[model samples]
Target chain A: MTNNTEGRSAFISGGSRGIGKAIAIGLAKSGSNIAINYTRDKEAAQETVAEIEALGKIAKAYQGNVADFEDCQRMVNSALNDLGEISILINNAGVASRGSLITDTNPEEIRKVIGIHVFGTHNLCHLLVPQMRAAERGDVIMISSVATESLSGRGAPYNMAKSAQEAIAFTLAKEEKVHDIRVNIVGPGLVETDMGKRLVKATRGVEDIRELDKGSPFQRVCQPEDIADAVVFFCSEDAAYVTGQRLYVNGGSF
Target chain B: MGELDGRKALVTGGSRGIGRAIVRRLASEGADVVINYHSNQKAAEEIASEVRKLGKKAEIIMADVSDQSEAERLATESITALGSIDILVNNAGIGATAVGRPHVATASPDDFYRLMAAHAFASHDLCRMIVPQMRESTRGDVVMISSIAAQSFGPTGGTYAAAKAAMEAVAYSLAKEERGNNIHVNIVAPGLIETDMAEMMVKFQGRVKDSINELAADSPFGRLGYPEDIAGSVAFLCSERASYITNQRITVAGS
Candidate 1:
């Protein structure tokens, strides 16, 4: 996080909904200009922009596939155009496949998971690190999943990719230490969102999920704002010297 | 605007250590401050002196917060002087002993109770007295100065840990009950702080400087915390930057 977010602009991927949107609104509330990316979901993206603007911060919407390297670069350029420097980057866009064994997983879903979670995060950092290097401060937030270390995921592709995401993140944290840029990952548990609702619907109910969540001392399903609050905290001066950290905002759920 | 411009702040135990650091942090952010001290009138006045140099109005008051009545009195006086408190930091706390003597059969129950009274009970009293003002204005911040002992289960820290643990519970209850008022309450727990208490702990605990330094270097931030480190969290709680944050504890562990 930059020491001051007043004149800074944050670029958030998949900010149209879920925790990403909550983070966008949060940063806007902190007086940071915003640039949000959505893949052809113009209405959703525009709605996000409106909310950000309502907080009295400038916001622009970008249409780009965050998973593709070239398109990720384009999104960065667009955000930079929208606001001269993209100071904070939220690599939140992701796709979670239904539980499928590694052997049974479709090749397409494998490609989708790897492309979005790994390459997408890599693409943005490779392009944006130079600017943060120049500015002497920046933040990169990777929205990882509990599947990375949890017993719940049957989707091997997602679990494997997210696990790899942390390795890449730690590597970047080591590399970016000199630039005073922080790279951290926020690993979340079951959150109530469109993706979560879909997972619940496909499961037919949220009882077991709720029961598993209550197993934690917190006794509640993780909310999108819970994850968003972590991102906000990570970007605040409270984390000025915090880097290379993997903070779990998973409501005490192991 | 500065994050704390024109905000009214009350800092307990502002005479020394982390409390003094918080006073400097808030004053720099444009808040008029009231510094409360249990003793060391000279130290409290010195901190207020620095606040005034920052062009913020500051005054020092003497009161032992370990006594519930004195804590309530301190709250009342600050409310009257500051017109209303926009920020309240419960940093006034006393250690059971400056030396981290391992708990033996000889541990002092009276001293333990004093530690609990100083940190936990006084904090509760201050919260109860200040909540009405915080609720009426619908804008206030309450920051409890907890410790790593609260979260880490420190050895021989029965009194310290219990006080901090109970303080966290009280903070959550206060935050939940007053959420409608928009008041934010958070805990700032510091680990391996570079303070006199830390020096005592490190020395008496037989912790070598090199080992402590290495541990500090192991944190994500790669260093032990200065008082300013924890003060930043306190300032954030009081700022426009943290309007929606409540019922949380932020550990300023170097990492």
Candidate 2:
């Protein structure tokens, strides 16, 4: 509803569905054109583009695997060509690790999860940050998880990947200050997205996330839009002086 | 209409410096405010007039919040004036230089207690008195204006750092305790803003020969932070845009 980011464009990885889609829409609502990146689900990506277009903003979908540097390069070039110099990068693509102890987990599963979360984030930043440095201002937001804080057992891959992502955020925040680029981490707790539902169903044996509301802070599970709100804030001018900060959107609970 | 239209707020130390900037920023966002000051009635009234010019109701209340009885009275009087306080900003505190920053070994217990009472205990008392009523409102926000010293704890800053650290602990705990009640508690820790307090600190430390301007020229942004810079983050934290954020510290230090 606020045109806080007017004339700016954002490139959001894994923006076809779930939390990524919510962030794409939130940025659009804040008056930024969008380039949505998706590895699969072209239809979902197209639908998101249309939704953003309906808001009177430009939107396009790019197919890319963020884990691969070449794919990220190609997508970044295509997105820049279509969207005209994106200044906001939302590294929201992530994969959950299978809940297995390190001893029982297959090494391949660990690699795949880490590749998607850690390497994917690095690939995007590597490709886009140079161009971002030239812009009047820029923002990079990492959609991390509270797993970094809990470091819960049986999810070593997820926790490690998010921690590394935050490490990059803090490091980049310091390095890019001279360029007027702000890097921040938005860590969400259990949310009501596809990934969150699967996590809850797999771990807690609950078919409906609402059933866990009694135990959750604020008597409800976090929503994808709730996480999106934080991303928008980090990108807004209201946060112009804030950088290298990590805001956990877990309703004040662990 | 502004995002905070019809909301009521009470800002401590609202007479000057960062507190004045916060009072004006919040009023501009459509919240009627009560400006709390200890000794600067003129400055408080000036900010009140500025708030009134923004088409929001503004009131000034005088109380030395470091004193428990005065803090209690401030809360009661503020609630009486504004009907209900949906937003509370704990921005009152003495400067590190004012307290004469001393190393841990040389710091007096009296100085430690004085700093603690002014920053940590004052915030704790106000939260205790006002947070219960905040629960009855649709939304509630409490922001502690902390300092980056809480983390740095640099040399000769023991008392100041301890006070800010204690305040942060209270804020983090209150954030969790009131989450179920729809209240969001956050801390905004500023780094060396260009305020009278900062000027005094810089002068007292003799960091520069003449002015903070010389120091600002060498700073990261090529300029020292302004009170408005801190106010921006505070305004955002109190807005609906930050509804999902709690128990977080946003350092407005131009990292």
Candidate 3:
């Protein structure tokens, strides 16, 4: 509830749009400077940077592929130079896998999904956590999906990737506690993001995401801000004693 | 203004230790609170006065929630005092030592049932009586203050673990059933907090001859968790900041 992130700096991957952007803005609003990471969409990333700057907080965008360890290193170095002592890392950048069975899916697709979600999370933590150790406190939030819980058929790559990402989160939670670095996971059920729209169109053939609202809890689908709110709470002082935890922002669906 | 301004909360066992900390935290967040205490009227009155000093409504109700009829009365009286319970914190329960932590083979059925009544059944009764009115409110939040014992299920703690686990089941089921009505239900499981209950456990065990502080030196945080640690999570769950969170258990165990 307090401004726990005040005077701190955060580096958020995939932070140009969707849930990542919301988290970036939320942390900025909570008084932290922002370093945004994006795989593509430089214009969208810049827009987010501008929004954070408007809030009187420092903001910058770094273009890099999180799955590439070298690229992650490059981004971390640049962000450290720009932001100085990045203490919060939001592993929000992710790619959804094609909803196909493991046998039917191409190996390349599986690797790409896993690389973005699992390996990408690892690369950031590997780079930023050491600097975080020297700071006052540190927070790592993995923007995982509810797929880890559902494990629905034909979504093996995504489910496996998210499950692995959470495994990293839980392990890091314990490993980093000695250093005052708290690790937690935020799992969101079907949100009205661009990715959600695409998935719905491909699977349910629903053009408008709101059409599924009647079947959704509270008669509405989850929003990027809804997921962001959970991340913000985890980053706040309210969760000072909370770690190695997973909060499902799914309207109690799963 | 506090985030919980205009909200009303009812916290069970709210006179001492973790429950008392929760009462203070919720009141500090601008919520009018109904403090439910089984005994120790002096402690309950002291907490109520503190809340009133914060410019919030504070009322103390006495009832042993483990009794089915007393739980009903607590629910009715809490609503009468606070108008509608926007936040309900089920925190009134005894430590493992109170029920006699014995091996499963030697554990008495009486102790098992007593533990169940004090935790699982008490929570069930309060939720059933309070949730219907919560439906008409803008938002409702229920937080179950369970312990890590429910998950760990360590030796000689079967009765307590079973009761807490059963309470968690109720929390999960209620979360799903009430999500449509904008109600959020979650659990905060604390591990070895520095409370009187924990001290009682330490004294009962007899193996740890050292004081609580010395014993806490080996904990994950190098110190035992404070009562405020558990209260912070409970207050966060009750606020709108956690509106999307439900059917989840956050273990505030440093690890």
- Indicate which candidate wins on DockQ: 3
DockQ pick, better of 1 and 2: 2
What DockQ does model 3 achieve? 0.72
True contacts kept of 3: 0.76
Q: Rank all candidate structures by their DockQ, best first, as comma-separated numbers.
A: 3, 2, 1
Candidate 2: segments with Cα more than 4 A from true spot: A1-3
At residue A81, candidate 1 shows an lDDT of 75
Ten contiguous residues with the weakest lDDT in model 1 chain A: A211-220
Superposed model 3: Cα runs more than 4 Å off: none
True contacts kept of 2: 0.69
* TM, chain A, every candidate: 0.92, 0.97, 0.98
- lDDT (tens digit, per residue) of candidate 2 on B1-255: 777898899999999999999999899889999999999899999999999888999999999998999999999999999999999999999987877877888888888888999999999999999999999999999999999999888998888999999999999999988987999999999998888888888888989777877788766556788898888888888888778778889898877
Clash totals for all candidate models:
0, 0, 0
Interface RMSD, candidates in the order listed: 6.3, 1.9, 1.5
TM-score of each: 0.68, 0.97, 0.98
- Sort the candidates on TM-score, descending order: 3, 2, 1
DockQ of each: 0.17, 0.63, 0.72
Model 1 ranges off by over 4 Å:
A1-11, A15-37, A42-88, A94-138, A142-233, A236-238, A243-254, B95-99, B104-106, B208-222
- lDDT, candidate 1, residue B249? 68
The 10-residue segment of model 2 chain A with minimum total lDDT is A1-10
Q: Score candidate 1 by lDDT.
A: 0.78
